[model samples]
Structures are given as structure tokens and as C-alpha cells.
Target: MVKLIHTLVDHSDDVNYCAFSSSCLASCSLDKTIRLYSLNNFIELPYSPLKGHTYAVHCCCFSPSGHILASCSTDGTTMLWDTHNGQTLAVLKQPHGSPVRVCRFSPDSTYLVSGAADGSIVLWNVQSLKLYRSGSVKDGSLVACAFSPNGNLFVTGSSCGDLTIWDDKMRCLYNEKAHDLGVTCCDFSSHTVSDGEQGSRYFRMASCGQDNQIKLWLISFVDFLGCELKYECTLNGHTAPVLACAFSYDGQMLVSGSVDKSIIIHDTKTRSILHTLTQHTRYVTTCAFAPDIPLLATGSMDKTVNIWQFDPKQHCTGSLLEDEPKMSVENWSEEEVSVWLCAQGLKDLVGIFKMHNIDGKELLSLTKHSLTNDLKIESLGLRTKVFRKIEELRIKVDSVSLGIPDEFLCPITRELMKEPVIAADGYSYEKEAMENWISKKRRSSPMTNLPLHSLVLIPNRTLKMAINRWLETQQKYNETT
Candidate 1:
């Protein structure tokens, strides 16, 4: 079933990288040029070669949706190209002050991440093709980068032989000394694999290095230690340094390209080689699997690109998540909870939580309390309507599912607060609602009826965060429900 369908030899020099979109193949080369080929006919597109870089183009990546292609070069520039007509969309000059080594698109296709010889990683917004953020992995150059399927995590491999996993906030979640030699390539699965022991489902990550091995990993939640990444297994069949690895759309097959000019396709479950492709005469540097197809693309230093196809369909079977995993709210900080609340547009809930010292984990108990007697919540004037809304949200009506948790609902207007603020008497209310209460209605506390000490409403940042976490949890359950 393994067959080379086409060989594209448009590059005048060594091809550094290659990628497969749904309709096209893109390759960058040491000729300081980028090229596109149509997968339908296996011929170069009418635009042919795109020339702009002053030095060798080191890497190129197609966004998940196949809308944009990103290329980085030794010219110290990264360019975004419109994949349709081969026009430059945007250009970033001297992002790293050295050769841009690699670039990748986030699983969601909303972000583009590029790594360079200067040890810097820059994230670009795909829509605007503008820089979103940038950071350094270490003093050593970043050679490879990947984003988890959930879009919550990413991993970068540095020349110093370390692999660092980071969260959406760019916080290092885990770091591993993966290989004795610099890691040459890394990729994430399109599907998640379950950690049979922890009963956890997580994306599988594979990294190949100068050590001639491919390492597999998964992010798992451990009981006392919180979230952790576990090393799963290793495959070692390549005779020389493995330069690239990619997971099939279904995540059942793992493909590795080596300096020995051989590509090994391993069954991920058995860690056994299923096929060995020796069609390239020089070191194979890059490879990619089309997200929903059987096609695989690989490039070599031999200045050629090969498109290989398998007979069997390689689409994801279904979701790997059987049960929604719980994120620990026991240690969630107040600020974190507040952020969630704000994101959910429920700032009014913060006051009630603070008035009662509510932790996000205590939501079940909070639900047990009815609207009639929940610690003087409804007594507040504007808050009465908010509590009413909470009562309505707790139940699934004839069609609508259970909405946000009752406690997170704003007390002033009986809706999710647009801007939550704390009034003087330690009760949370919508800032606008409170303003109306004091100015239009009366100059007294809605709940206490005491003269207003101060109208200053402190933002309930912690509650906002809790609201966000809660929403995410609910959404996850809804998917698997």
C-alpha cells in the first residue's frame, strides 16, 4: 500500500522542509525559494517557485485549514503566503536575528508558531498575520515545535536536548531531558490516547532526535501531583539520526524519516515497524500526513519532494474522550476563578462567593442551597432579579440545557453581569445596576438598606476565573454526555 505517487524536483538546492494541505503541497529549499505543487495532478502550480528570501529557506508550514502557508529562512525573516495564488500576505523581518529554523500552525489554525536559531519562539495570529507573542525556550536554538490537539498546550524542542511543554499562558507545564542529542523533529497527534492507568485521555506527542530514536509522550493528570506528562514508549529502528516524525490522521501510524534516507512507519499501539520506505537517496528532513487523508509528504536534502499514499482510509474514528476528566479546582486561586467569571460575563457572582467564602470546588454544595435561603442573597434590591435568574438556569427546560451555575449569575439584573463590582456591604452586584439603584432609586444599600459607604465596586477577578473554569468543565461534559 506504500507507494510514491509523485516526485517534485523543482528546488535547485536541498529541500529543507515540506508540508501537505488538503489540495496542495508546499516546500522550501536552500535555493532561497518556496514552491507549491498541486496534489491532484502532482505538478507544480502555475505560480511555480516563489522567490523572496535572501538566504536558504529553512522551513515551511501550512495552516490546518490550508488557507495560509508560513515559511522561515536563514535570511532572518518569516513570511506568510496566501496558499491559493502564492502571494505574500505579510512579512516579518529579523524576528530572531538568525536563521529561522522551524515553523508550525496551531491545531486550531488560529496561530502560527516559528522557532529560530536565536533560541526564540514567536506566535503569530493567523487571521491578521501579526505577531501575537514571543518568548525564548533557552539559550540553545529551538529546532522543532508542536501544538497539542486541545490547543491548550505546546511543546518546543531545543538544541540543548530538552523538550519543554507550555500552557496557553506560556507557562512551562513540564520539561524533559528527552535526548542526549538535539531533537530534530516533534509533532502532536490529531487524536488523544488514554493513559490506561490514570484513566486519563491526552494527546500523544512524538519527538525524534540526533540520537536515532523516536520518543512518545502524553499529558496525564496524576493524583497528588496534579497535571503531568508521562513518557509512554520509544521506537528505534532508524540506522542514523531521525530527522522528522509525523502521526497519521487517525494517530494509529507513526512515521519517521532519518538521515539514513529511510522512512519507517510504525504501528503506534505495538511500536512495531509496519513499513520501511527507502525511496529517497539523501537524508529525509521533513514529513507530514494530511489531516484526513492517506497521503504523506516527505522532503529530502536530495532536492526532491515525495508524495506517498496508502490504500486504507486514515481518518479519526471518533472522539477518544469517553468521560470528561475533572480539572482540580481545590487549588484554584481567587484571581484565577475571577478571570473565569469575567470571561463568562458573570462578574456579579463574585460578591456572593466572597460573602460566603466559596471555593470553586464547593459548587455542588452551593447548588444545594435554594434561592429562598442562600445566606441573604435575594435581600439585596438589584440582587433579587439576579437570584431569580440563577433559579431558572439550574434546570433544563423543555429544550435548553442547564446553563451556567446559579452562584455565578449576577444578582442585580438576573443575568450574566457584563461588569461585576463589589458594593460597600460585601455583596456583589453589576456595576451599572448598582449605579441605577443609588442614583435613580435611592441612596442606600439594596440588601442592608444602610447608607452607602462607598459605591466603588472592586472587580471580582477570582469569581470570573471560577466561572470560566466551570463553563469549560460543563462544555467538556456536554460533549461526552
Candidate 2:
């Protein structure tokens, strides 16, 4: 586990962005070409090089499906490539006046969004091969834009300290001047909870800024006349400008990389520092957590990406022996037990199975009949029987159909399988698809290759009004049902 996995060194100059496919890493650099390196530890040089940008390639991203690669460059252009054939499918020319700093594909891989030094944000329809709409922020340069997990909303951070949220249709919903200095990064977290009654959905947003602060906002219900969005809390800690921030997949931890060359992990609830990772020798540029693994990756100006493995068992043991002395099961009161059970996503099991209430009652006698046979009654000596019963229950639960909506399904493969494989048209192409697409496109499109330019203007007020209306409609639907 502590081995050097891979070292991708094809970039002739400073690399700005590095993203992962299922089996490869795609990196963009000031050298203007995006390089794809195999994830295998043995592979050294890039498996393929995509060269098309007339200037430095600022950012490169893989679609959620991993079947498409979208790249933006200092040439003021964006290109879409067919991941399967290494073909340039489309070229977006001069989308902005200045260099495009960053570009990202929508969660569904149906759209592309780019931010530029010209203080403009452009949304493009991938399938239709058309520029949908462009909005001007009228501030400093646009740094980053991220679509929410639900794909229904997105947030853009600006160099002028503004953070704006927009709908999927490219309408600005919430506009706020969030910081005294430029905002560097932001992310959204959604969690499901059963608060004594029934399971409900909740979301929170985290943002970092050049003002040396990390702020958190709970997306809660608001009794308002115009908008239902409201800011909840601001978590301030970093001593230097924060460069990047991301939430764990489980929405329990928040990690922020800062210009101070440190990565800080904060508890999502308490908004308190859990760990301060200080290994990087230079400014930590970016950090991301594996979606399904207990691994954290940090990229730095030190020219290295450090991968940290999180050991939950060791973390629990250390917590139990901390100076403050964490409360154990033996010290739990009635209220604490309820909280623990709820926190484990077992709210329905609360009060139904109490150790104190069990006397001579048969294991299946006191509970709901439907769950009795499903339960595994065990003893210290009945190890074999207990394991068999546990396996049976797991199979039964796995077989149960929860009727999850298609929207909740992963867009990559349109399925609910664990560790989902990225697919397109019923085929699972290897990770090289994105790189192949970029390479093919560059060879075909010469006229579209140009450098980016910059400009500044105000965002459209009409688009903001439209987005506000859409949010209000969704809120009303949720409230009614």
C-alpha cells in the first residue's frame, strides 16, 4: 500500500490540472498538451499525448461516463473529444475574451462549462454541439465552476470574491459576494438522514477564499417571499489563502488545501479541525478523496501527488484514547444511545431492540414479524450457524428492490452496481478513450486552434430571475409532497 503507484512526467512545463479515469490519469500543462498516463505502477511516460491548443492547456476533465474528454486552453477555446476513437468531436472557438482557466463536464456528461480570465462563464450543450448561453460576472477572472452531485445546480467562484450558484439550464439562482478577497474553491455535500420520523435529504456547501477562510452553509428550508436559499454558518480556520476544498463522499469530513502548504480535515458537523496534514513542502494545489475508497490524494506545487490511506479502525482506537477521552458504549446514557443508533442510519432499530429489555424473551418474539426471520440469532458457540444466517440476510437485503429513481442512478453506466464501470453504448472502453479522443480531434481541427483572450462585464439579470423561479418550483413540490 505504501508503494509508488505512478509518476507521470510528460509535461514540459508546470502542470495545472490532473484528473483520473478508471485506469489512467489525464493531466494538462503549460506545455499545451494533455497527457494520459496509465494507472498501472509500471507505466512511466504518457500512454498518449493530446496536442491541439495553440497555448497552454489550462484544464482537462473526463466526463462522468469517462467516454469523453473536454479541455480548455489559454488559446481561448474548448474542445470535445470522442474518448473511444481519439477524434475531435467538436471545437468551441473563442468562448471567452481571455484565457480559459478551467473547464468541466456536467455530471451527466451532456454539457460543458468553462470559466475564463475574461470574467465570463459559458455553458455548452455537448450533444447538440452548440453554445447554450454565456454569462458575464463583471468581476475579476473566473477561477472554477462545479456542478452539484444532483446535476441540477452548479456554483462558480470568481477572483473578485463572488460565488454564484446556477441551475442546470444555465440560470443563476443565488448571487452573493461571499468573501472580502477572491474565492478559490467550493463544493456541495448532500446527506440522507432519518431524524426520528423518516428519511429526509439535506445538503450543505463549503467554500474557501483568499481571505484565509473556509465557510460552510447549510441548505435549509427558508420561509421567504422571494428565495428559499439562506446562508447557515461560516467555518474560519486556515491562516493563509485556501486553494482547494472537497467533501468526503459520505459528507462527514471536509478537506481543504491551502497556500500555506497544509491540508486540513474538518468535521462536517462540529466544523472543527480533525487533522492537519502538513507533509507537502510547497503550496497544496488540489486534493480529492476516492469516491469508494478510504484514500485521499493531494497534488502540490512541490510537483507531487501524495496519497493518504485512512484507517478507520486505527482512527477509532485513537479517538477512544484521546486526552479528552471519548465516550464508549459502557458510558452511554439513554440519549447517547439514541444518538449513536441514529447516526449509524439505524433509526428504525431504536427502541425495537433494547439490551436492557431482553429477559427470557425469544430472540424473534418481541420484534416485528417480517424482520424476525431476517434476523440472525447467535451465541458465542454457534459461530458457523451465526455466519450462515448473516450471509443469508445479506443476500436477502441485496436482492431487495428499493426502486431507486433513474436520477439517483450513476450517470456513467446508468446502474446501481458497486464500484460502477464507466460505459458508453453498452461498451466499457478502457481509460485511454479520453486521450484517444483528444489526439484524434487535434489532428482534424486546425482552424479552431487559437489562444484565449480576456474581458469583463455584468451577468444577465434575466437569467438570475429564471433560476430563482425554478428553485422556488422545486421547493414547492418538495413541501407539498
Candidate 3:
């Protein structure tokens, strides 16, 4: 079961949208205000309240960098606010005759998109506060719009269940019936690679609707044939309307929140229900996952936003205990069994990563160090200098040994000592071959070096005490000004 770390109650009205940053969460509500909450202290009042919307705020989103917020309201206006100071930056009045339902910033943060009840979608130049292009869909109101992860394509879903894809030039590329009922929310998956499968270099879109279904589509750009879009798969598990849907960083798991008062995790390839999370007491209106963290946040009409931790161990189970109960007990010593059990327990970690918005892309990657790794400046400063020297030495050594230029090396695989793991020979190693060998040795030996720490069982308490002392010494460091 997932647990909530804290519950924040501030909005007297229904929270229409909730977005998270590294240190804060921004929520807009029908109370005609946007509130910013510091995650570290939820009991404290919001760090600031942004009040400008005259009517109910429909949607609010943080920019990729978390520095700016864009919100749409029923007052037929979209406003941009400075997140740091709670100051309104710009206000854009609707050119059409309807309330703005959705507003989002482009992946590059250079433009903003807003969809309204008047069946119109407008793009604005954020820096200049100038309107870029205004496009109209047929018959129904535009309910949702999302910019593709690559920023080349943008899509809009209508109340009539029609999905339209547009290029940067505002040309309509693909138009199709996406759902039976009104489309409520849409998201695009970023480029990702998992296990061995690589996601599309472009972008894949996920859309949820009142039809009680979530649909995934592949978007492709064609020079000669124009833009070609194809329906990939349909995920069906929700009993009521699916209000929001988002793809995980790895693109293997897709999460959808519904009016059924449940959140469902779906395997994108098989379309199987992996987990059904039932915690929300009311209709879920919005849901989003942290790009770098294994955390998910959802807001519902129940006047609460829930934070969930994604536990990977709930999905993977090993059969070592089932096949050989006696052998498993006899062949492995108590210390070995303890290590195995610890590994199994570690698998249940909340997989969260450090996220950075760079060059308009949300880069999700592992944190630089372990959770227990201290930020002691004395220890860390020396390590940082050593790392720089090592990098310089590595470049010099490579220039002398390998005839290939440094420019030709693949940036993704160039760095050594990237992720340290144990070798079969029981020594720590940084090469990929060492990791492969350790995986094979794990079938017999209970000991393996993890990314965080190296663990071993000692025969004597004295040895354990000595190791603990060494760890304490490493952790004790004074910061030098």
C-alpha cells in the first residue's frame, strides 16, 4: 500500500489543478486563487497566495523549470505568474466568447497554449506577451491541449471527442475521433529507454476521456506525405470517466486517475492493469508524476491532494523461496540470508530521481549520490577535485591510447566510474563487464555491491565495530569556508 507523507488543506473550493516543483507544489482552485505550498512544511500556511483570477481557475501548470506558472480561468483570461514572488507577469484576455479551460507552456518555455470553450486554441509568445497563432476546431469546445515532448507537435482534444494534431506552423496534421465522450486530459511521453526497449524518438501521446478509456497514439512527421499519426493501443479499466493520464519517465507504466475514485497503473505494451490504487474519496480531477521521482500527486474533488510512492517491488517477485525451501535455508548462512532479505527489501524503494529542466526538456536521471551520502563540504570538496583530476587524466590517457578522437566517443557511454558495482572476484569495479559478472555471481553468493553501499557479513563482532567506526569517520567532516 502507498502512504501519504502529508495532507495540505487550504482551498475552500475544489482544487482544479495541482503541479509540483522540486521544493514546492502549486495549486489553483475555484476559490479564485492559486496557492503555493512548501512540501517541507505542509502545516504552515502557503508560502504565498496568488490572487488575480476573477472567476474559478480551471487549470494551473508550472513551467518545466518551475520558475513560472500559467493559469486559465472561467473569467476568459489566462495569466502568467512569477512563482518566486507571487507576482502576476501577464494577463491574456480571450479573443473568443468563452472561458479558457486549459493553459500550458510549451516544452521550450517560449510559448504558451490555451484552449477555451469557444472551440479555439491560441499560442502566445511568452517573452513578448504577444499572440502567435489562433486556431479553431469544429463544433465543440477544446478541452485539453498538450505540447509534444520534442516541441515539434502540439495536440488538442475536443469536447466532441475529436483529437487534432498541429505543427509549429499551426497547420492541422491529423484529425480523428479519439473517444466516444469528451476528452478530458492528455499527456505526451518523453524519450525513454527501459531494460532494453527504446521508446520513440519523437513523442507518444496518451489521452483520457469521459468514454471511460485511455488511448495511446504515435505521432510521426512525414515530409512527403505530411504528418502521419497512428492509433497504437487503447487501455480500458476505468469504470467511469478518466480525468487525467500521464506516462512514467521510463514509458513502461502509464498512470490514469478517474472519476471512479481510483488510480490505475497500466503496462503500456500489454495494456494490463498492474495496480489499482483506491485512496481518493472523490472524483480525481488531476494527476501528475514527478519527472525525476517515483512520486505521484493527484488532486480530487474530495478537497485533498494525495502523494503516492511508486514501489517497484510490488511488481517483481522471485521464486527462489518456492522451489527450494530447505536448500534456501541450509545453503545460505544466517548472514547470507539476511543480506538476501535486505536486497529484497531494497527493491521496494521509492524510485525517485533528480529532475532538471534543461533546454526545454525535462531530464530525469538518478541522483548523484546515495540517500545516506552526506553533503559534508570537507569530504565532498576533496571528492569533487579528485573527480576533476580523474577526468583530466582520463582524457590525457585516452588521447595517448585510443586513436579515436574524444569527439567521436558517444557521450552516453564515455564516462567510466559512472555507476560502481561489485565484481565476481569480490572487488569493487566500475566497468559494465563487472556488473554483468556480479549478476551471475549473485545466483550463488549473497554478497553484491549496490550503487549505494557494499555490505558483507563478518564472523566477529570486533570486525563489525571496526567497519562502523570507519563509516562514522567518513561521515564526520567539517565544512571549510
TM-score, one value per model: 0.63, 0.59, 0.63
- The runs of at least 3 residues in candidate 1 whose Cα sits more than 4 Å from the true structure, single-residue gaps closed, are 94-96, 221-227, 313-481
Candidate 2 has its poorest 10 consecutive residues by lDDT at 445-454
Residue 153 error for model 2, in Å? 1.8
As for model 3, its CA RMSD to the true structure in angstroms is 19.9
Q: Count the backbone clashes (under 3 Å) in each candidate.
A: 19, 15, 3
Best-performing candidate as measured by TM-score: 1
- For model 3, residues 200-279, the per-residue Cα lDDT tens digits are 34467899999998988777765556675555557766768999998776676788988888887776654555566667
Q: Per lDDT, what order, best first?
A: 1, 3, 2
Residue-level lDDT for 225 in candidate 3: 67
Order by TM-score, highest first: 1, 3, 2
Q: Write the per-residue lDDT of candidate 1 for residues 1-481, one digit (tens) a residue.
A: 4678888888889988888888888889999999988877888888868878889999888887788888999888888888778898888764637788888888788777878888888887778877888888765888999888877778999888888877655666677788788898899888887765457688788999999889888765333354566666678667689999998877888889999888878778756456667789999998888765678888999999898887563232221111112244444455544543332234567766566665544432344244346655554533444443334323312112446554465655656665667778667777788888877857666643446777667987777777778768988998998
Q: Is candidate 1 or candidate 3 better by TM-score?
A: 1
lDDT of every predicted structure (CA atoms) = 0.74, 0.60, 0.66
Q: Residue 263 CA error for candidate 2 (Å)?
A: 1.5
Instruction: Please give the lDDT score for candidate 3.
Output: 0.66
The 10 consecutive residues of candidate 1 with the worst lDDT sum are 317-326
How many residue pairs of model 1 clash at the backbone? 19
